[model samples]
Target: MINYEEILNSSVVDIKPSGIRKFFDIAEQMENVISLGVGEPDFKTPWHIRQAGIDALEKSKTRYTSNRGLIELRREISSYYKRKLNLDYSPESEVLVTVGGSEAIDLAIRALINEGDEVIIPEPSFVCYVPIVKMAGGVPVIINTKAENEFRLTAEELKGAITEKTKMLILPFPNNPTGAIMEREDLEKIAEILKGTNIIILSDEIYSELTYGNSHTSIAQIGEMQERTVLISGFSKAYSMTGWRLGYILCPAPLCKQMTKIHQFCIMSSPTVSQYAAIEALKNGDDDIASMRAEYDVRRTYVVNEFRKMGLSVFEPKGAFYVFPCIKSSGMTSDEFCERLLKEKKVATVPGNAFGECGEGFIRVSYCNSLGNLKIALSKIKEFLKENKNG
Candidate 1:
């Protein structure tokens, strides 16, 4: 035998597959599966945004862009933050266009993490933070945010997780899986704790535009925290531009310089057509965002209400399009609950354990599908609950 396992990097090999995709893959193989699994938005890219890409192709703008991305797109990114978030960033030095928010995250981790450095991550959050930290040779110190706290990372939790070796703290607000958001007051508390520390923050705010009643707030917006925070966001969730593969990073010039080095060697630049399209998104896509958010709000309310009526304990989410509902009453582990639900009811939903150990006994349900589909899926789940009450 060739013994490929011996040749492959053990660090990469030993990592477990993403728990979010397990049931999603299973549903893909079967017939008539109603999935609330994947976190993708169901909306199409707006016509004008798509037209911009088409225009780029017609004008033959297919060559590689600057290593930092087209200056025009970068300026738009800067302007968007300035106009929308009241945060100032220089397009030339402090902004980097990335392949996606995921890439920006990876670059930030690789740029800042030294071997044995500890990264404090709040969970029931995204799955990527831990693995990314591990790959960068950093230790992941996890703080499990309680359900009673609406899954927000409190200052007490952040204080307790900090150590001398702590290098970065990832703030995944408008968080995935759980739809928790940290308002301005929440950010202030966290900023207060890090006042004198050397700790940097990796704030992933990809879903910033999707907040329910209240607006989204970045920790960087608080006092001097902007100097220490790397803000990663993009056109994915807000503009429904996931497949376009465009995201950006905003931070201090020093950090951007280091991250750009990694990006230059690993990814020459983000997609040119996508960048052209993104400029248009930043310039004129506010209406699109508003429309999408309104529709998502409707779906969000419906899903949470339905789950509550099922007698399941659900943390009412105020941001993002997901609802994390506790399925402990079903007397099944998260994985078992998801698998049985998929097999018996033909409904596919991700187990909450995929996000972190603390997510066990809950299921993360995306309301990103159509209203009709959601109604059908929720009804099927209700049937599953009645049929298998304690199994």
Candidate 2:
């Protein structure tokens, strides 16, 4: 027999599969299960944006856009950033629209990392970062965020991890799996630590617009740090455009050139209709974002408060839609707690270790479902916990 495993890249075998998917597999088989396991928003893409895409299909503008993406879309993205984030980029050279934030991150990592270089990614973060870093021939060094700090990465922690091999740091905020965000003051401390290092920053702001109270801050917004930062954002979260697969990369002119070459070779461009739809999203999507964010805020508050009343220790989430709650009170490991909750109550959630090590005692609950569904799920969870209590 042919030795297929031997021929496959050994690195692929070494990487751990995402723990988030396992609960989903079990949850999928059962009927009437209430899942707070997924990180996606429960909203549909707004009608106007969807209509623009339909119009494009009718006009038959179905051919591929230029690898650098449409000039009009880039211009619109530039304007959108300026109006909303007060950031500026030259559309002609600095913006390369991506298929999604996933591709944007892949392009950024592949463009910057040489073999054996290190990418420092703060943990209890998105599951994709470490694997993507490894595939690009880089080492993934994880830094654990603490619950007391609301999981924000501290400057001291970031500074301690840098070494000569460190090439980049992915600042993932309004973070996944834990709704952590670093406000301007929080980022300034990190900016100070990175000033002397050669480390480039990948500021993944996919959840920027979803922050609850404070306005989102980009590393690029800080003076001098802009040169070292590539802003990664997309319409997936804020505009309910996950299925649209639209995102972009904004970097300094030199890095933009490097990333553009890889994007040209790999993706060509994001979908043409999606690009048109994104233009509608960027220009007119603010109200849609605000409305959905308001709904999420309502649910976020509800879940965190409900979890606390259940006697679970929950870190206060200022952004994104997840609540990272400690489940150690029941003497069950995060994994054991989640598995039991799903099997017994038909309520699905992801274990904290799914994100990284320090996530051991906790579980992530996304508030991306209907209020009625969340209330029902919480009741089930409460009953399960009370029944399982060791005391």
My TM-score estimates for the predictions, one after another, are: 0.99, 0.98
Candidate 1: worst-modelled 10 consecutive residues by lDDT: 19-28
**Considering only N, C-alpha and C atoms within 3 Å, which residue pairs clash in candidate 1?**
none
lDDT tens digits, residue span 1-391, model 2: 9899889899888888899888888899899999899878899999999999999999998899988788999999999889877888999999999999999999999999999999999999999999999988999999999998889999999988998999999999989989999988999999999997789999999999999888888889987898899999998998989999999999998999999999888777779999999988887888899999999999999999999999998878988889999998989998899998999999999999999999999999989999999999999999999899897
lDDT of 1 at 270: 90
What lDDT would each prediction earn against the true structure? Answer: 0.94, 0.91
Instruction: Give per-residue CA lDDT, model 1, range 1-391, as digits (tens).
Output: 8999999988778788898777877888899888788888999999999999999999999999999999999999999889888999999999999999999999999999999999999999988998889989999999999899999999999999999999999999998989999999999999999988889999999999999998889999999999999999999999999999999999999999999999999998899999999999999999999999999999999999999999999988999889999999999999999999999988889999899999998999999999999999999999989997874
What is the clash count for each candidate, in the order shown? 0, 0
